[model samples]
Target: MSAPHFYLHNLGVPLLLAVVLFCAFDLTQLDVLISNQFYDPLTHTFVLEHDRLFEKLTHKLPRILPDTTGELAVIGMLLSFAWTLLPKGRFSAWLERVRVAPALRWLTAHRRDFIFLVVSFAITTGMVHYFKSHTSVWCPVETTLYGGIHEKREWFENFSLLHEAGEGRCWPGGHASSGFTLLALYFVARRYRWRHARALFIAVMTLGMIYGSTRVPQGWHFVSHTFWSGIIVWLSMLGTALAFYGRERLSQPALDAPRHAPETAAPGLSEGLSVSGR
Candidate 1:
């Protein structure tokens, strides 16, 4: 497909869907309506507001796993770069035959992938946090509807300059962004033509939505907050991919290239690594 068509199919459609969903929630009362289901007016609390099991599994684990994955990717990227600086000799040759050789080869071949992942993670998380701090939107728990002093405000009202930004910091859900950030993995897998690319894409989307939903039951965010988080993270990652790979490279067919594709380096740098394909 042409680059325009590839982008439309891959990025445009998803973006449109996200905007439509955002509008549905923002323009309507769906955010309050959905939260009402999990909320108890009598107790003025969300059903799962303080459930330890739910909090640990859905909130804590989801946040930690993505962070841990990003750290591992950073380490792998560093190791791959370090491997290139090692002098070629008996020691390096012997190391090539060891099991670590295949991993190093894979890392070297996909160095850009790791960079994209880390950059996307930072961009998404930063955007979410920035929006959260600036916006006046309150979490369900903080609004009078859930037994707080602050009166509930509509989505657009929160953006008004006259509106006082409180301590709520719940606008574009942070926990949800953590989940949607995994969308980077799907993009990377697709770029490299990983055999399970389709499955990975579906899994990431499902996981993101599930993570976002968990916050709703805890009264930590409205549904629209999660929707906006997905939109932000998706666009951030898409932009990162375009900047790193360029349209021409992204539009090209995926190749089952050798795991140790020769990178432009010292004359014999690539020769020190195995040329095997996984």
Candidate 2:
């Protein structure tokens, strides 16, 4: 397959999944109906109100720069073009060998990576769900700045702009978790080649940071939320990598032993004895 197609196959599903998550949060009007108490220090009055996502998008902008869909598409296009331009060499051959048509072999090569992705998604999702039901301290990132001093409110006001938003109620910084999980997977899987491994590791780390920062502008999470979420993700990935690597080492030796030597029939013994006598 062509490079662009290859990348699309690998990355499209993940991107789509993220989009679905963001859309779900935006569409359910959670941002619109959530109530918060705002204190006006000058008037010494507290106002309780519900906030909307549309309002947040229009007014309370994030501190980080916005990314348009068009811009992202263009970037993907350029990256794909660059990948296709690279010359094929020994490294390419090795990569192909590892990626050959045999599904079992490929799975064996990428099992840890696949497991990491699965586990990361499950754990993050579960945490997000569990926290959504029990949190009352106010998303710590926004306790003072967005919600004021009120403690009786069940919901926090959504800041529509990046400038006004605070932290998340549930598991904050979902992006950080997603990005760091992938990073750890790459780090573990790339042990065969140091240079390529380092490059991939750097790329994933950068992506995780970028993803974390977007929470601020998106008005969904705070900086601290992102940081803590990232820590959790990093720890999870590291633990998973160690476990997977250990299991692989213990189970691999039996498979590596040769089953049998090249066979020579009894007739071959007669041919060996007549070599010089004739």
What is the per-residue lDDT of model 2 for residues 61-122, given as tens digits with 9 covering 90 to 100?
42122223223333433333332344568755665688632333233333333444455445
lDDT of each candidate versus the true structure: 0.74, 0.42
- The TM-score of candidate 2 is 0.41
Question: How much is the lDDT of residue 177 in candidate 2?
Answer: 52
Clashes of each: 0, 10
User: lDDT tens string, model 1, 1-278?
Assistant: 69779889778887898779767887788888989999998887899998999999998877777889899878876776755666678767777777666567657666666777888888878777776766767888988888987887754565645444566688787787888888888776655555566677778778888888898989998988877887778888888877766666556554454222335222222232322211
lDDT of 2: 0.42
Model 1, runs deviating above 4 Å: 97-102, 160-166, 252-278
Error of 2 at 199 (Å): 2.7
RMSD per model, one decimal: 5.1, 18.6
